[model samples]
Target: MMDVPSIKDFQWKTLAPLPSRRVYCSLVEAGGQVYAIGGCDDNGVPMDCFEVYSPEANQWNSLPPMPTARAGVAVATLGKRIMVIGGVGANQTPLKIVEMYNIDEGKWKKRNSLREASMGISVTAKDYRIYAAGGMGGDLRPHNYMQHYDMLKDIWVSLATMPTPRYAATSFLRGTKIYVLGGRQSKYAVNAFEVFDIETRSWTKFPNIPSKRAFSSFVCAENNIFSLGGLRQGRLYRQPKFMKNVDVFDIEQGGWMKIERSFFLKKRRADFISGYLKGRIVVAGGLGNQPTVLESAEAFHPGKNKWESLPPMPTPRCACSNIVVKNCLLAVGGVNQGLSDAVEALCVSDS
Candidate 1:
């Protein structure tokens, strides 16, 4: 087991705020840079704006805007370039336009688009290819389409369709498999767990998540997938509910086990950023406790099997895009009372 650090080991700091106040944007890491792609501006209009953050200089530089103005864009880092895929466009329509930005050239290039306009799509890059899976389409239906864009061919090829159609689902690449976890079919949530084998181009259904979530976050830490806080409906038109459930999925074992409540989050927060920092699983900034966007943050040490209170964020926001860079967990633009341009990071030392 790794030595657990005291709460003092974690430090939260604010970086240069994003130039455009937006939410549902695509934020990703590539070539030692963090790129903020298209998302909706404060007025709820889709934006074509794009920018990047350089930790070395503590500054942000504007890249050329994407060709299509859209929000909720799904983005993936492909080597030095970025693939900007389907998203919600202006007029609240799902977009099928796909574009790529060459960081070195500072220009956008077109790629073969998806057959259907998709929103809430989750995309990830591995082995020089991009995998796009479950999302809501313009038809307002959850799509099970699983496709991959082969860089060499500049084409999108369909793979085995997901058995469960859902949107707002998240996929995490583990070895040759991609695990697609909990998402929503509509107002109702789905707890389905499925994995796509990249080598065989097939799908495998695993144990469903103990708690169904749509906008929730499940982060990887300690060689396990920790399904964190989420929001769901209550019975009989009751108010929506927030969850503090801590479900642990052992990657090697292939099953989920709900942990004790003592280890649950300090607050019931959903749509937050959770990631492994050093050896601790750090969660920060999301919607919690009515009328209060959360700034409070906490860390869970696997070795101790307990939670540790940490410093809160400088700003309160939810749906903030996150990507790990070096030893920092970067929280990008999200909604805070309105659209937010705030950018912050939680840094943990090697000690």
Candidate 2:
């Protein structure tokens, strides 16, 4: 029999931060550029601004702001265009408005609104379609809504609703299957995981996470799913309350395992951004219960099951979104004190 090596064998490096600070925003890659869109500030003020980062230049440039400012929106890319979906605004109102940005034209256009307003949802694009799932709606209630947007038709249609209603969950696609993991219900954090088969138009439950959690970030890399840091029960802002544990699930095996290596992040995170890069899972800024926001970054190598530190973002934030474009990771607006205008970049090394 062969033996597996420990996670400590991997290496990592830090990169420059974004130009501004933001939280709860959406990020997507289009036309080889990373776009960061709407999110809130530390004070919970929502924003409408957007920005883009070019890995070749290692710089950020401003873009047309969203027609309506919002936080917790979901952003996905369809060819050279980007779609921004449901979220909440400064008034704490849920929104159903959907917008699209044309990278070549540098203009924004309105699209069909979502069936319902929601915030703290996750979105992914696959096979010319965008899937949005599980978020809180108006009245601050979580919903099980599962919807899809067709890029070619610029329309939306509802699919099967999630079995469990949740908020602040993460969603991604692996092959033809879409998966949603970890978030909060009305009562407590949930570790529930579900998968949707686009071809069959059905939903199925997978093995639940070992621990219940919310505001955690998830990424799919090399056919594996990784769930990272978020808050656990305890006094607000207290130390040892944040979780550094990393959980991995194998879609082929239908099994889950916890990575023994420690993330070594300074704090536990919630409402952070994460994405797959260069065969690794990269995580960015988020907030802790001290209720403090963080700017640090980390990379996890699934093959090694270990975490390595990366360059900290210029602006510390929480509730933000991250996207990969041409080997670069773009972090968009998130909460700092109020809704932020920050846009940062992480240049993934070729090595």
Query: By TM-score, who's the top model here?
Result: 1
In the range 9-119, model 2's lDDT, one tens digit per residue, is: 322323335555665656666666667677665566888878776766767788888899887677778887888887887788889889888888989999998878887
Per-candidate Cα lDDT values, in order, are: 0.85, 0.73
Q: Mind giving the per-residue lDDT tens digits that candidate 1 earns over 1-351?
A: 778667897898889988878887887887787888888877889988888889999999988888889988888878878888888888898989899888888888999989899988877778999999988987789999999999889999999999999988888998898988888886677898899999999999999888776567888775788888888767686778787878899887877865787778878888889888778888998888674799899999786687778999988889898888888888988888777888899998777
lDDT of 2: 0.73
TM per prediction? 0.96, 0.80
- lDDT, candidate 1, equals 0.85
- Model 1: number of clashes? 0
